[model samples]
Target: MAKKKSTRRPRARPEAADAPPESANVAQDFANLHVWQIQAFRDILLVAAIVALVWAGYALRAVTVPLLVALLLAYLFEPLIARLSQHPRVSRPTAILGLLGTVGVVVVLLIALTLPTMVRQTTQLVTDLRDERVLARLVELQEAATSQVDRLLGVFSKDETTPDGPETPVTGESDEESAPDGPIPGEPEAGTTGPPVPNGPAVMTEEQVRDLIDERIARERARVAEAEEGGAWWFTPGTGRVARGGWQAISRMIGAVVGIGLMTFLIPFYFFFFSLWYHDVLEFFGRLIPESKRPRTLELLQKMDFVVAGFVRGRIVISLIMGLMLAIGWMICGVPSALVVGLVVGIFCAVPYLGVVGIPLAVGLLVLEQLGLPEAERMGWLWVVLWPTVVFVIVQLIEGWVLTPLIAGKATNLDPVTVLVAVLAGGSVLGIYGMLLAIPLAACGKILLTEVVLPKVNAWTRGEARDPLPLN
Candidate 1:
């Protein structure tokens, strides 16, 4: 009976013909699994990490600035270290130490000489402003010019009788028309005024005019001297007090020293380690990816190196050349502070448009220091206008025709307009530091977008499951 019951087991239920297959079911299950949720969480965590990094950078500028500066120094010197590392007998550490020592010595020497001069010049200028009554004189000159202009305007206004229109001629022997008899001796005859005696020579004699001008100038100078004497209150020791007083100045100096010291100590270390280990670090990271991707990573690194190294090294060479040229030019012109001027010009040349702007300002200031206001007013204008313009034109020519082609070539390849915009944008954001870093950062972004992001986007548009292989 049991056997019969088993044999007569109920017919199995028929599965739905439209049901999804096992593989589809498995995929759907996988989509709902905790593993996928965990992965999503990981992705969110990564994004948050990136955001935190960005926020940290913005929030901690004091810490970030030094690090950024150190990094830049590292980049600048990496190639030298690499070259030294390649030497047969030189150990990497020894080479690094030697390079750092040389750099340090040079920097120390420059600071020792230049800093004292800068401080002395600044202090002297401040003292001169107070003692020479520069502010008062400026105010007096402004007032005198305003007064002279108003007086001239008043005289012109008074001479015009008709307010609304041109002066009408006297047609019927009006009172305005003079009918005086002038036939007496030493007097003009009727209708013989001889064009009003030509106004006693429209031009004054040289000596007369010179004397008048000298008198006016002496008056103006006296006024300026008075004003300057009056404005001497600002420099009075305790007349005006800073909020934190002298302590603030000392604090600022100490802060500057600390900042500079930190940079000095850390920059070489950053440069050395980054130079020695950057390639290996990059290679190690690349190895974490699939073997097929290593070439692409390496290529990106190489391109970045090319852009950064070219900019930094080219700038250094160009700066040196410009400095030498400026020094020679200044010496030829018999300019004082030729070394200082040349150095300033050379340093400013590192900036794009700043060199053009700064050279003139510096020259003008130097000329002012060398010449008094009157002499400066006469000759300083010419020198200031001529030499700076010449220097700028020559520099532009050399940059466009020679240095740019030879050094930068198509490496950075940014358009001039683009570079200017980048500089302005950077200046607006981070000031000088931002301006200094703008080009390299832009280049790096360009490299990243071209090599990393664009290819994936291209593949996705083509419905490809994977990115195309990068060209070496």
Candidate 2:
């Protein structure tokens, strides 16, 4: 009876008993935040990280661009190596070396055969743009054209003088002879001219202006030649950077020919290694993904492989055929620098819709004929412009109707609008290389979102049963 009475005396503390579950589980609650909880913060952090990474990549582009280009080129040439290896007595390494050697020889021959013409044409273009005489000729033509138009409209009337100039024949050659010859009398030339002209600015004739421009161009070209021996493009494990001094440094950095040559030399080596090691490399990367995600990851990888193999490799083939076609057409049409233009257009056409830009560029180069050279040899317009269009259209017809179907086979099923946006975005982000790489990356993204992301999301919403791989 006494022990039962004592039970009522042992009462618990109300504060301890009344404590809320939320306080005890504060860490777990924070860790277990749902997608809706603090979602913006998480998303913002992720976006910031991605942007920072991209900015860093761009900042280090001199290093990264070459590596990426090499990797992609390796993908493009892997099949060729495979085909070459299939022949009896041809090992993989031998095939790689042989194919590369053949490519190098072909390239050297092309350059040796066509470089003089390209150089001559380019020089002419530069001269026409900068020379006052050429510009004067252009002005004369403009005035003549305007007078003709005015007469047609009767705005000048029969009694009126030619618009903005003395009356002249339709050719309007008078102004070409009208440039004043002597320095104006009363003005003093700046700096001493032997004895008299020290107080005023120097007088310049049209010829003098043209000469000065030519001198400047020559000097700049000399600097460009100097720049060819300039600094390294990327850091090396054992070597420090070459020091470049003066304004020439800026030009050298931009022109960096030694770096370019190094990269060119390195490409074949890297390409060979990439093909040689691709399986090992792929396996290593594959092992990186968690076992649970391997199925979807492998699927996406296979999709990317199809695109790289069919589209990227096939583009190289298409470019070669198209370029050869255009080169032959331009040569037949007598277009100057036909080889160079064809080569450039062919290379760029590897990019989707880039052919549009390439075609216009080829046409503009043709129109450079309007500037003509020294009253003698200004011959880019015969069928240079017109025939390129024919070549382009015929190539396009064949490309669309036959080549793409047989070779690339709709590897990139992206719509034109999507391709355009991707190209623009790529260019804005990383320039020419980005433009080159954009479509394949777009295809990868589309595959991931359509086949992986959306399905995962829908399944999650429905709380579907899973078939996750067994954990390692």
Candidate 3:
């Protein structure tokens, strides 16, 4: 018994326990650290990542913008391709090719039908604006308006006495007679001297205007001929400054053309590849998310996709329809450059309420067209104003009642004030691209606030969530 029951059992071997009980307490101490500390670290990391991403995008805008545009195109067209490919007869590649081919055919047809007329009208419009006849008419209207205003003022004045001195009427003949023969000793001559200077808004005879126009045409032709012959078209016998200006203009035009060409090529190249790999691309990004957070993230992303697709696709279709309506209406009303104006208005229509800007543009062009016409042939002022207004109103009504309800269907749900603010902020920060993206971004922000942020705040308030570490 004495041998079997020693007061202290044999000491446990060192191999049975590597560390003391204090090591377990140390782990418990670390686990007791405030939840806010870990959360703060996460928050800081997230903000840093976002800032880095934004900086990278901005720095690589030249490359990124085209890629973004392509991605958007891919987003727009992918659904159609997917649907088409679901048919047993149509493969995805075939679906893509067919859909794209159809779009290409439609676009080519539209260009073939509309381009020549648009080009001719554009040229004519430019010529009309520069016409001596048009200028003389505008001057006459201005003087007539001045005289009418003066007569009205005279009627209201208490003093009827005329000035003592012989009043020199505002007339071309008087200005010409009083003109100096030579340039002022210290001053420069007129910058452009070829077109005859009609003193005091003088009207020129039809023959003189015709002759001047012919001379201008000949000069432009000569410049073109020189350019074709590999000579400096900017150089003329009498002027040196024009050479530099002309060269600058040509350089700018070339730059613009090159930029446009590059964008045209890159957009299609990116779009074709993006469309082919659309699902794969999405899956790649999806894999980046942690498995635990994926389901919630995917839900949010799906909601965002709905909003963006509804807004973008529906708005584009609505705009196109409205543009066609406008063009047809204006053409029937004999508004000059109707196609061009309608296309411009359509682009403006992408932003809510922004299409209103096109009204003044349409009216101004109508007025200009009327001014260039014979008085007998010109539309009444009432018709000129009313027709465009009617067209705009009708189209807007259809857009509001039909297109919005049927297509967009409250996807954004943003109030007008919110939208206006978003548009303004976006336009100020990123110009047109920002403006285009603003509403969708605002919608996404609203979703995040309501779904992610507000719930967290409420829970925290009720002591159901961790308190964020205070900045102070």
Candidate 4:
């Protein structure tokens, strides 16, 4: 055997040439790497991957939003679909299709029932904004605010005035400005400087802020009105026929139509197939994990999924209940656009207490109605602003103390501050989509951390070995 050791290594097997490289299991290539090295590498890769995914998501948000919407709709309708599937005559696909058809019909009925009235009331709102009485009320509000500010300023100022007359807010006027011949009582002259009187029309008056807001709003409203007034057009050069606003409007319209078309085409496409293959999708994702960890992965996934689904569905139900409350309250209060405002506010109720921000507009409409009534009728109408404030307070109490606690709070199990901060951060980063998604995403994250992540981390800390990183 020593003699046979003569310079000959064993021949490689034929199958060896066809064998996959160690790199095929990429982790295997690094099998001999130091633990710290491997950890560093993985950490860097993970950060890079997250960055790439975020960039991709931002770039693909056009398709992404529709896809997400479809996913949400699927989630919303899944229970119903499942229930229907259990019936003798129905299968999953049939159930999905049937439910979608029912949704469509309901949507159509809703539009038919509400659109014309909403349009009429909306027009009335616009016209009312310019009404003399409304303008007078607005002026009265402005004066009241100004007077209140004046009083506030007076508390920090020294005033010398006629005993019979009301004390007015002192200004930064030099005595020379008020009385050129002599220094006004308690006021300094141009030549002499006393302690600076903190004054001058209360810089940036509340009324001024209101005026600025009103001006900006008016400009936007005028622009929209102009667009509506001259919206249609026949023909023109270059663009050949175009919208009333010309090429710009035509382009916008075209873009809008394309977006609508894509949304219409994609949502149903996604929902239909997803509804049919949801379990398959789950399996596909599940199989990405190693056989050993699949059980744990699946368990964790189910928990997160349950949390998200409950939060989403519970939130929607809560919104509906809140909307109903507002609708009934508004109808009883005889608020104009009661249905439209209540529903609009209600549907937006998913974002914690964000919905109540719209109450001022509702209040304004109610105030207008109250003022329009005769004197005797107006007497019974609560103070112009108080009715809306009361309504808002009551609705908020119902939402906070009843609907939310019974529904969304239970669904998410997130404290108010956490939910609010998440919503705000999400809104800052991604606008409406972020706001809508924040709480559910947070819920999922909490579950993931507690169920999936922590368990594995604890196992490692306890010196339990891992094979191919558990997730495979």
Candidate lDDT (C-alpha), each: 0.72, 0.75, 0.85, 0.78
- The alpha-carbon lDDT assigned to residue 437 of candidate 2 equals 81
Record all residue pairs in model 3 with backbone atoms less than 3 Å apart, i.e. clashing.
none
Tens digits of per-residue lDDT, candidate 4, 1-472, equal 4565568788999898889887776767677677657778789888999999988987999978888888778877878888899999998888988888898899889889989988997788778877777887766656767998999888656443335576667776865477557555546657887775554554788789989998998997676667667863222232354344587877899999999999988998899988888878778977889999888778877787777888788778988887777877877777888877888888888777678675787777777676667658763434556765677679889877887667755766778888889899889999987998898888888887876678888888788846435674
The TM-scores, one per candidate, come to 0.65, 0.62, 0.71, 0.65
- lDDT at residue 445 of model 3 (Cα atoms): 95
Candidate 3 is scored at a TM of: 0.71
**lDDT (10s digit) by residue, model 1, range 262-333:** 876776667677666766866777779778877777788789889978987887788777776776676565
Model 4 residue 426 CA deviation in Å:
2.8
Clashing residue pairs in candidate 4 are none
- In model 4, the runs with Cα more than 4 Å from the true position are 1-46, 130-137, 147-258, 367-382, 401-409, 452-472
Highest-scoring model, TM-score: 3
Comparison by lDDT, 1 against 2, better one:
2
Report how far residue 386 has shifted in candidate 4, in Å: 2.7
lDDT of 3 by residue, 1-472 (tens): 5666568778887876765588788878779977656778779889999999999998999899899999999999888889999999999878877877898899899999999988988888788788887777676667766998898898757355666688867999889999999875445577744545444666789789989988998998887788758866545453577777889999999999998889988987888889999999999999999999999999999999988998999889888888888888877877888888888798888887778887887887787778777889988878889999899999999999998889888999888799999998998999887888899999999999999999999999999998897667
lDDT of 4 at 115: 91
Model 2 misplaced stretches (Cα beyond 4 Å): 1-23, 27-56, 82-91, 127-133, 148-255, 358-391, 428-430, 456-472
RMSD of 1: 10.9
Instruction: Residues 207-249, candidate 2: write the lDDT tens digits.
Output: 9987998899899767655655574333332223343344567
